[model samples]
Target: DVKVTQSSRYLVKRTGEKVFLECVQDMDHENMFWYRQDPGLGLRLIYFSYDVKMKEKGDIPEGYSVSREKKERFSLILESASTNQTSMYLCASLTVRTGRGTEAFFGQGTRLTVV
Candidate 1:
């Protein structure tokens, strides 16, 4: 099974503080993604990496960035935390070669509360 592990289950960041959330996948999948889940907004992508050193901005990439220095590891960086950025952050991965939706495996999730 594909396992995505997040660095933290929860985090609290003060306004303007920089925050980092890490994710690692056991599977050799090529695609990794980061998203913030909100009540009515569902899951909005923040960033994704298809290969080491390659990163792509997702729908909601503002105030965020990412790093993929290793095939199995990905990181999300919040340049400046704000109350609006507080949300449940989830990490996922998939194999683009697979036609199957593969239902992106998710991390336990990091509930980030920016105060």
Candidate 2:
């Protein structure tokens, strides 16, 4: 089975601090993504890395960045934490080569609060 793991299940940081959220997938998938969840906005994609060292900015990448140094690992960096950036962050992985039937698997998510 595919396993996606987030480094933290919950986090709290003061304003102006830099934060790092890590994610790893045991499955050798080709695609990994980071998304932030809000009540009204639903899940907004922050970044996507399709292959090692290749990444694309998603719909809500303005205040975020991502890194994919290894195929099994992906990291999300919050340059300067803020209250508005507080949300549930999720990591997902899937094999792009797979057809429509393939599905993405998500991690438990990290709930971050910026105070």
Candidate 3:
């Protein structure tokens, strides 16, 4: 079965600290995305990668960066964690099939708390 796994399901970090959130997919998906979920703002994209070593900033990328060193792995980095950054982080992998449309699979999610 295809699976998207997150390194941690819950995390707590101090303000101004560096944080790493990792995600991995077993389906060898070509597209990966990082998103954060807030109370009323919904899910907002932070970054995405189409292929290995290729990444693009998404809607809210100001306080985040991403790394895709391999096809199956994507990593989100918080340069300096802040209280405002506390939220539920999600990692997703997309599979685009010819004439079949695209399907996205998401990890369980990492709930990060910045103190």
Superposed model 1: Cα runs more than 4 Å off: 96-101
Which run of 10 residues does model 3 get worst, by summed lDDT?
A: 95-104
Q: For residues 1-115, write the lDDT of model 2, one tens digit per residue.
A: 8899999999999998999999999989989999999999988999999999999999989878889999999999999999999999999997644466768899999999999
Better of 1 and 3 by lDDT: 3
Candidate models: Cα lDDT each: 0.92, 0.94, 0.97
Residue 9 lDDT in model 3? 97
Arrange candidates by TM-score, highest first: which order? 3, 2, 1
For model 1, give the 10-residue run with minimal summed lDDT: 95-104
**Residue pair clashes in candidate 2:** none
Tell me the number of clashing residue pairs for each predicted model. Answer: 0, 0, 0
**Best lDDT goes to which candidate?**
3
Q: Choose 2 or 3, whichever is better by TM-score.
A: 3
